[model samples]
Target: MSFAEQARPIERRTLYDELVERVRGLVVEGALQPGEKIPERELCERFGVSRTPLREALKVLASDGLVQLTPNRGATVARLTVEDLEDVFPVMGALEALAGELACHNITDEQIAEIQDVHRKMVACYEARMLPEYFQLNQRIHELILEAAGNRTLSAQYSSLAQRIRRARFMANASDARWKQAVSEHEEIISALESRNGEALASILKLHLNNKFHSVRKWLISQENGTRKG
Candidate 1:
């Protein structure tokens, strides 16, 4: 066999993996709300894929806590409750704090500059009240920190848990005051990173995550109460 023929190009992504990401985005971006039935037929038509791959994608989502599967009832979007936040936030907070500390030590000046650029854009999004764009940039900032931490295991673990709460975390900015406070917190985070102050960054990250948990917790409670009243 010729060398060129033997060294065939690798497929970057599988159909199943692509389907999983597309479906995950639908759930994360709130196109598929929590507890809503997974409309298999509609999605299959929309994506021009068959049930087999779609269902397989959903199974991956279920494992990630973004979808729930049942024997008779099929699948539904997994609802993130206050209880769920209570369970996950502390762990996430610790992970984020650790990431902040490690990133301060490990991140290069160029990487820090990159994050600052993204942060500036995020602030502009906040000023414009562009929630969707702000949320995307906000997530990117945290992801960059995780990448700088240089721990594959930590990144994998944090990412898995983050997927479960991405939508709820995005909605935590519903309160204008809380949104302002979060931006202020991000300012502090940038300052600490710029200074390479690991301790300060860790504390700020923990505080930031704690505040977000409270914001989300309050929103979830109000939503549940409103449902009951309705």
Candidate 2:
């Protein structure tokens, strides 16, 4: 057989994988609220998939802690408790601090410019009160920093924990005060990165993550209190 003939087209993602991402987005974006039942029928109709693939996707989400599978009750979005943040954020802070330090050593001027551009856009989103867009850009900046760090192991570990708490992180911006404070922190982050001050960047990153934990914790406590009142 000719080498050309032996070559294959790039494989597309499987339907099951696509369903998993779509369903996970629902959970992350709050379309499927925490503790709310996963409406299998509605989703099946919307995605035009059978129960088999959807259930498989739900299983993936459950493993990610984004959903809970019950015996007879089916799946529901998992709630983010203060305890979850308390456990996760400190580790995330340490990881982010390390990433910031390494990024200061390794990142190129062009990479810093790329992050600055995104940071400007994120600031604009904040000014406009576009929480979702701001969050996406905010996430992109951190991802770029991780990429700049050039550590696959750190990236993999951080990403795993990141996926588990994305919804809670998004909710951290629910307060205008916290959001402004976060933006101020981002400014300091960029300045430190631009200066290539590894220690300063590390300190700022740890403090940033710590503040985010406080914001998310406050929001979760408020939510629990509201639930109790209702």
Worst 10 residues of 2 by lDDT: 167-176
Which window of 10 residues has the lowest lDDT sum in candidate 1?
A: 221-230
| Best candidate, TM-score | 1
Best by lDDT: 1
Show model 2 residue runs off by greater than 4 Å. 1-9, 128-130, 174-177
- TM-score, every prediction: 0.89, 0.85
- lDDT, candidate 1, at 215: 83
**Model 1 RMSD to the real structure?**
3.4
The segments of candidate 1 whose C-alpha lies over 4 angstroms from its true place after superposition are 1-9
- Candidate 1, residue 66: how far the Cα is off, in Å: 0.5
Q: Which pairs in model 2 have colliding backbones?
A: none
